[model samples]
Target: GPQGPRHLRPLLDTVLDALHTGTHARGGPLPTGGPDTVTAAVHDAAGDLLPDRGDPDALRTLVHAFAAGAADPAHPLCAAHLHCPPLAVAAAADLAASALNPSLDSWDQAPAASALETLLTRTLARETGHTDGLVTTGGTEANQLALLLARETHGTVRLVHGANAHHSLPRAAWLLGLPDPVVVPAPAGTLDPVALDDALTRLPGPRGSVLVAATAGTTDTGLIDPLPDIAARCTAHGARLHIDAAYGGALLFSDHHRAKLTGLDAAHTITLDLHKLGWQPVPAGLLTVRDAHDLAALHHRTDYLNADDDTEAGLPDLLGRSLRTTRRPDVLKLAVTLKTLGRTGLGALVDQVCAHAREFADLVHDDPRFHLHDRPAISTVLFRPAHAPDPAVAAVRRHLLTTGRAVLGRARADGRLWLKATLLNPATRPDDLRALLTLVHRTHAEGPR
Candidate 1:
């Protein structure tokens, strides 16, 4: 066990060198020739799935193949999803987390990690005007937990959400065995407060029997709902509110953009994901509760992990913390990132990415070759090649993907398909934006290859 660190040092060098070699081989945002080709290459690199005796070079070989095949979000052209390029410092901390392999399920297994989690979650909860919170796998789990908590509070509460809400919300309702959700119209690409109020009034449920889920940022177009009005409607209707700020929650870090989340504090539970904008690795999500008492719904029991006797004996109860038993000390990387960057540094990155979106939107607006869907509400810009049929637009995105030219997302807004660019990489430059659009325009002009 003591030799673990020494053993890791040289292996890390090989991994880093392999990653660099793979990126060089890739020569673009992602590997060329699409899925089949990438799969074949990976299979070759992997050699045998399992061997009687392991190859010493397996780590370096696999890591190289992994990097080469990955759709690197750090690349300037890889502006597809809410996926973000993680901060270097955060990734470094993640390595240590993996090495120690602390399980948060028991205080004995992860004493310092447990304490760090408690301190971090509480501090982050206060940022959202909450009393306490839980660490989730991501927005999906957070949404599921929010629904779980709501259901526990009010027996079989109906889920009422906007059409703009993420698919996870309705799916979570289904998984929890709740009634089919009532979806209000998002005609303007956001939850229409009036429509939400109407739905709330018409729904046949007791005052506290409805849980209204609203989106702070819609996935397709990145449009934020009118949260203040939605919160007011929830208050008046006596319905509980859970705002999914997975995409826009990081705006809270920015003084300029934090005002956009004026009604965030009103939600009974709030889902905030950092992987999208916090420059952290995947699975960084939190669900904050306005009242710490709400977390009682998740209180769990087990003899080995968090025994009653152990809890009473001043050892912290860890079973009530999560839905999973063997979760990592994910808080470690987050804590490192927050401690290193603080609020202002992280906010500056947010501001820069938002600005990049605006600049890209401008490029699309000024070019007759493309049509800007709308000015970006956050850091997502939607634009389409001018007068291109929806099929052609879809074809253009696929062409770029297959050819490994660029990575861009597609969305349906205003009954038309538009190219979606979610600019989460703050390092992206204006020239890169122009090149991305040029790739789309050129592909559309040349037709699908």
Candidate 2:
């Protein structure tokens, strides 16, 4: 059923060409297209498809248009979020994975993919001082799973997290039917151990079950919670600790900044998103648990997929360890990426981004127009133009986005709106960052129009 390479060449070539045209030919990180316009364009493109006919050219054009209109994270000016430009090799591996379409639910469906995922999970676990883990769709799913495991281990418990924790934490609590989390103040954008201890103490009644969730790199300010101190406190209180390192897990690979995540190994569970700092494509989220037996909460028996007898017979299956029955073998691309770029290479990329963030922070500090919130712990710089109101900041962001000049991040922190720039692209240089800052200044000067 496999198509010969000769037969696939033209189609692959068309796709590659379309990608280059869309990404390179596009003037900026994004196109100046409103929702209505983009929606109409998408509708028109969809109309070209027919059940019985396939037009490669039409498909290529549509893909090119879609890509061209996309927010280009590879652009230096696209310092908005944790989105990182994917590595080319990983992208190619993703294509191969798509072609294979391996489902990881069972050994029969995945085979080598399941083995590779198990291997990768083990390797990642060892790196984080764990025994096993699983790949997830992203941080949200990983965090949710971590909470679920915590809930399974410790009954109806209060979830505790920092103010700058990802929005997913509360949502995960809601989904898990756990009470609203205890929100601790993160004045400096990182959790204060004393504040967290006080929060735990203030809890009503004896603390039967408590899951203290910590952030490794908060999305807004890139602050890492004092993991070692928090771990010690959690140990004292017999509370389970979950570190959401979705954005900052790359620090594990960084030779210079790995110490920032000093207590990562001590966490009962940790969430890592490769898409953010690992330079992989999207949906490269991983949840690593310190104890492999803890995964029993997610284990299940299915005669068709993972029967007890089959396991007893030495048959390997991954269904017992996953929430979804049918899932893509995303680990394939991750494996390819890891092999292509060793740990040191990836670490250097992370170091580069962090260094850039520090430099940007210094620049913001020296500039009279902006107020640097705090020294960046990772790759995010949060600051606001002097005397700029929230509306003005919003307008500047909108003006740049609409004009396709830049796409920056906007967040509300410490009772005021602030602009944020996430330096995830290792290729971005100091000049590029300065240019982005200049754009921000120009947009701010334009006022709220």
Candidate 3:
């Protein structure tokens, strides 16, 4: 079981060398290859792996090659999604977590890791003004868990969310065997409270048992819904409110913008994704509930793992806190990040990125060739070229990606395709965004390829 440092030293050197090369020497955000090209390279790299073991040098070379091919989020032009360039310290913490490989199912398996998760979850809950919660894989799982708890508590109920809600909500409803959700329209990015009230009035029978899923930050427009109004409406209708703040929950850390999520504390449950805005790696989602009893719906005892008697005997188990059985303690990285950065440091980073989004929106508004969709509420600006056709808008995005110059986002707004820039990197400047827009204009002038 004892392994020598000689065995690990080479592996570490290989990985570090590859990482430096990939980050510093990469051509652009993405490599110049389509799916077929990359697929062929991957297949060739895997040749004779099972039948004949490859040399360490060859394997290391292949790993570096693959790393080089990945799209670089650290690139300023990689402003497509909520995919932020991970902090180096957080990445290092993640590597430690991977090496330790703590499975958070039982205390015996992960003693300190389980405790760390509890500590992190408790801190998150306090920040969101909740008593208890658990870490999840991402916003999808957090949303599903929130809806699942809502369904279990209220039995048969209809789901309600804005039209601009994430695609995962409908799927979550289906998975929970709930009826089709009543989608309230959000024309200007933010959900209209009048439209929501009208929709609630039109619902069949009593509205006493509805699951009102509110969006804190929409994906396309980065708008926070009218949380106070929505919360009041839910209370009036005797419905439970769940705020899906997967994108904008970082406002909790921002002193300037935390007011945007004012009514968040009133919600019955809230979903937050640290991966998006908290500057952590993927799979760091959190779901907090006002009433701890609501989580009892997901609880089940196991004979070998978390026996009922084990709890009575003073053995603390977290099986009931998760929908999963064998979950990794991804919370470790979050804990390390929070401790290293603190609230003010993280909040400043968020404020900086959001400022960049506003700056970009101003540029779009001032430019004659671009059309500003709306003033961004978060760090995402939705706009398109003034003269390009809807189809050409998508084409321009593809062209940018294919050329490996940029990796911009595309979305449909009001029956038309629009380009999006999710300014998640604090290091990105106004000049960088202006350069991106210039590229978009030049690409549009070339016409759709």
Clashing pairs in 3: none
Question: Compared with the true structure, what per-residue lDDT tens digits does model 3 show for residues 1-449?
Answer: 15744576777788888777755544788766666666776677666666665475765666666766777778899989988888888888897788778888877788899888888988999999999888999899999999999878878778889888998998999998889899988887777888988877777655447888999988887889999999998888777899999999998999999999999999999999989988788879999999999988988888787887887897877788798989887988899999999999999999999999999999999999999988889999989999778888988898898787899998788788889999899899778988999999999999856
- Deviation in angstroms for 166 in model 1? 0.2
Q: Give stretches of model 3 more than 4 Å off.
A: 1-9, 204-208
Residues forming the 10-long window of minimal summed lDDT in candidate 3: 1-10
How many clashing residue pairs appear in each of the predictions shown? 0, 0, 0
In order, the Cα lDDT scores of the candidates are 0.93, 0.87, 0.86
TM-score of each: 0.99, 0.95, 0.96
Model 1 — which ten-residue stretch has the worst lDDT?
Answer: 440-449
Give the per-residue lDDT digits (tens) of candidate 1, residues 290-348.
98898888799989888899899999988888989999999999999999999999999
Which candidate leads in TM-score?
1
Report the Cα RMSD per candidate: 0.8, 1.8, 1.8
The lDDT, on a scale of 0 to 1, for candidate 3 is: 0.86
Please report the TM-score between candidate 3 and the true structure.
0.96
